[model samples]
Target: MDTAEPTTVGIINRENWIGALPAPVREAIEARMTRFTVAPGMPVKRAGEAATRIFQVETGFLSLIGLHVDGRQALITIYAAGNCFSETAMIVRREHNHTTIALTPAVVRQLERDDFWELYHRHPEIPEALCRKFAEAISRQMASREQRATQRLGQRIATMFANLAEHAGESVVGGETRILLPITQSNIADIFDVTRQSVHREVSHLKQLGIVDKRHGDWVVIDSERLRQICSY
Candidate 1:
């Protein structure tokens, strides 16, 4: 599937540093920001790269990935439009631990580390906004870790689908919720830390139970509430 360019798209959720800033500050920052347009499947940043800049999603989605010594790749997380990345890395002056890529064609806004800090110190509200954003990120990370540790494979898949629906779902003709993200079976296996066969079984079970359908290269949740219930809501 092709992703629209950032210039052709608009922000959806307002969850990033850009949106968090007070209006005047946001405008000033935006004036100095540099925009990058990434094509679908493009590599935005790689592991062990210097953290020279902080990034905010202006349009489209990105995936965070980790590589193991055994040559295995893991999917750490997905970031949608209105999300921020690399702030912690920039602050700590460390290389990035994960590789980030465009999950679809994307437009991202970048600020030099020095520029970001200048704003951070100049505006009192900057730290407050960043604190809230980071706090929420940490909370979600902890919750996701806990859930993955305790939940069964099926339940975990359900939870993942439910979360995706909440973040990126769209209404369909028959009251179903559709997610346009391209999630392959291999990706699911990586996320669940399971085998491809296991993913196939669980996905097939979901399809058999009338919970989800694959149509037009995307996933449609036919009964989102039921899926949420399976995830323990």
Candidate 2:
């Protein structure tokens, strides 16, 4: 996490930003780009730190978390593989809004704030894409906040499962079946803004109703389409 060496997002060398740009322009940006490899449980940036760099994730998950006044953290959002975080930090050139933490071993590419501004000036389309991306982030945050404020515990929990399925789920060979939730119930509770005990009880209810079938280890899936229909409404 020490921003000292350049190897932040090790595998990010392959990301394509300006495919239509002339060769020289792309070369200029890539020359200044740097990558790094970081381990799990490392802090990428702390709250209130000067936003020195924008981070693009090559692989793994990153958490944007708000630490409560009582010292506990409420995870606000998760950035997955190929998505970029900390971009707005450079856009505003201000302090970080939330702490960024790696959930697993990850690669993060860094672009200095000044370098980003330079790139934006030369390639206007890049800035437009970044603007749209930031807007989407804000909209997602607003939706999550609204859902947390108005939804019931069961609904929020179900929404969490759906979000995970959208981002991380993989299809099993069982004829179009998909699986992505490898997290324990407690971790799922943390993600859903609920108590672990609540998740345990609700999971029991899901099992009883045949909404989810728990397999060996952390594997679980919906064997029936009825699960999705009931949870969605």
Give the TM-score of each candidate: 0.86, 0.74
Candidate 2 has an lDDT of 0.63
lDDT of 1 by residue, 182-228 (tens): 88888888877789999999999999999998998998999987897
Give the top-scoring candidate (TM-score): 1
lDDT of 2 by residue, 45-109 (tens): 89999998777676777766787689877666666665566777777788998998886688877
Worst 10 residues of 1 by lDDT: 1-10
lDDT of each: 0.79, 0.63
lDDT of 1 at 57: 83
**Each candidate structure's count of clashing pairs:** 0, 8
